[model samples]
Target: MFLLLFVVAFALTVNSHSYHRNKYITSANFFSGTIYSWKSDVVGYFKLKERNNALAEENRRLRSLLAEARDTVPFIALDSTVFPGPYQYYPAKVINNSYSKTKNYLTLRKRIGDPIEADMGVISSKGIVGIVNKVSNKYASVQSILNTNSKINAKLKNSFHFGTLVWDTQEPNEAKLIDIPRQAPVVVGDTIVTDGKSTIFPRGILIGTIKDFNLSNNQDYYDVTVQLFNDMTNLHHVYIIENVEKEAIQEIEDVEVKAPLQNRPTESIEETNQENDAE
Candidate 1:
């Protein structure tokens, strides 16, 4: 009998709430809309913390960028600066990245509008990401240094001796800088940086440190393994460098330098006809 009374009371409370809900459901559109509006605002309050966190991260990135600019040398326009050294910058963010495979690449959010083109891209924070291989309106792809095809001119920080930095086909963090003169003191922990010889990256840009070294019996240079500074496995944002002078240099090299003619001239049809007529 006590259980029956409790059940009766619970059913009455549920019925009362159901009647109120039904009344609201049958209410005019304006009344229902107002309630829903309030409900939506309440739901939005639940996501306030997440939204705040994202904003805070973006703000931090901006502040860091400002600090970097202030501390670094000012960026001079190509038209104003002269160079046996030419360098430029095109900032970008890593939208997609991979580093585990033997082949790797990073897709950037920068596009053609940003003055970024093929073979022009250097990471600002991480030193070098890779050259831009392809570009669309709002996207570009980079061939990461970890890829087998990637090569950068690198040198010992302490010595002027230089070499071609390449992959060893074994480790992601390591690469080989072949052709450093055997005289170079390549200890197990020597730091290697981008050689100013190439326009692809800035001089003194950190590449890696000498992880290990071995000299071939007849080789002129030591075989060096470098431990990279940028962990290719996890990268977020990078800066792209666009050498403003690159276009002019390319034009001059393509136009001014002419290959020497063959020792024996191959006769053209018009030349042969002229010779025959003269004969």
Candidate 2:
């Protein structure tokens, strides 16, 4: 009889208090939400690799389409032969990267069987990354643009003035552009791009924007600071660019021409005077 009376009192107390019922419902919802969140996180983690692969493949396809579109000409005749473009791109994963050294390098997961070769240009979606220095059957090493020895031909996007791109080892995301003649117009926030002087990188490939500028000690040219688009410390995907005509162009340039002193043309008096005056 005592146990029955206690049970009835407990039930009446719970039913009389709306706070107790609301607290019970809130606790149950919170516990379920946490469980669902954990489950979602685990599933997402497992699908990460798949998602990345899909994204890379999609990018490759789009790049190929763009290349083809650029190669195409309006009102051109269709032929059975497909002429290859001057540049070809191959996607690769950056397995290792280093940005905190005077001479930093990156390692890529490309094998010897791949069409990649030394001196080829490497770029990410945002901007230039580095150049391939060494390639083995299992991997390839890149000389990062952040390295002290890195140099590439870059130019002002709005003008034809070109300069040499170099790193000062002071900052990973910043680089220096030297040898820009004083006559060229320069302003902060101007875009810099590859000059297409070499067969490696094509013209108009983005390098960075001008952050600051000053005349060098000699005062013959301007020294410009560039802020890179890519975060050198964090990298994952990159594309290796191969110049299809690089070999042909290099071979033609390698042939040395020699002329006997007797056959060499002499400078005219007027030309000599002009050269002296310019000097």
Candidate 3:
């Protein structure tokens, strides 16, 4: 009887003490919280790939919407049909990339029916990647901008001064912009972008920022160094851009090239007048 009374008195004392009760509650919570944290970490580790895929898909969708919003210009046709954006984007995964070589290339895994073709532009969320050079049934190869032979038309983001973008094979993240007139007001940290001179990429797609500049050998043009925005060595997901009107534009260009000039003159007017005076 005396032991039972002592046990009841101890229990009442422990329960009545706020510090002891709070300590017990804190210990229980810490134990449970640790277990929950471990369980969540394990589950998250298992679901990492799935989550990455979901995020990639979400990014693709958001990019499509953004392209439509940015590129769409409404025009009323005779049939009253609204035309969509001229460029189509397809999400792809990088299967292989090579930046160490003189002519670096990247292989992409695309859906079988994705309509990916050579000359298409490849880009990441940050900036330009390369141009598609070859395509197979389910894969395409890109000529990365880091390659020595890569030449893209790029311009200043704030002005119309344009030049050809090339890589010097010295650094993976640095490229050269040549043929820009020396008169251009180029400054360090100025943004460089695609000039849209060709159908490969749209106008104003980011390329990089001007790192430095110097006059070329002839002193007629400026050779500007650009620091790329995209890390060329660490690429994963990319978007393949296809210009829908590429064929039609190419056809028109070809015809213009082949067409004969009208009202041709075989002799100069000055020569003709001199010959007439001699006669």
Top lDDT prediction, candidate number: 3
Off by over 4 Å in 2: 1-80, 256-263, 266-279
- Weakest 10 consecutive residues, lDDT, candidate 3? 19-28
Q: Rank the candidates by TM-score, best first.
A: 2, 3, 1
How badly does each model clash, as a count of residue pairs?
Answer: 2, 0, 0
After superposing all C-alphas onto the true structure, candidate 3 shows an RMSD in angstroms of: 24.7
lDDT of 3 at 193: 100
Candidate 1 wrongly placed segments (more than 4 Å): 1-85, 251-279
lDDT string for model 2 (69-133, tens) is 87895545667478667998888767667898877777776533778877899998778999887
lDDT (Cα, tens digit) per residue for candidate 1, span 6-54: 9988876564334122221211234433454455457547766854665
Evaluate model 2: give its lDDT.
0.77
What RMSD does model 1 have?
A: 21.4
Per-model TM-score, in order, reads 0.61, 0.68, 0.68
Give the whole-model CA lDDT for all candidates, comma-separated. Answer: 0.67, 0.77, 0.79
**lDDT tens per residue, model 3, 111-160:** 77999877899998778999887676666767889876678999999988
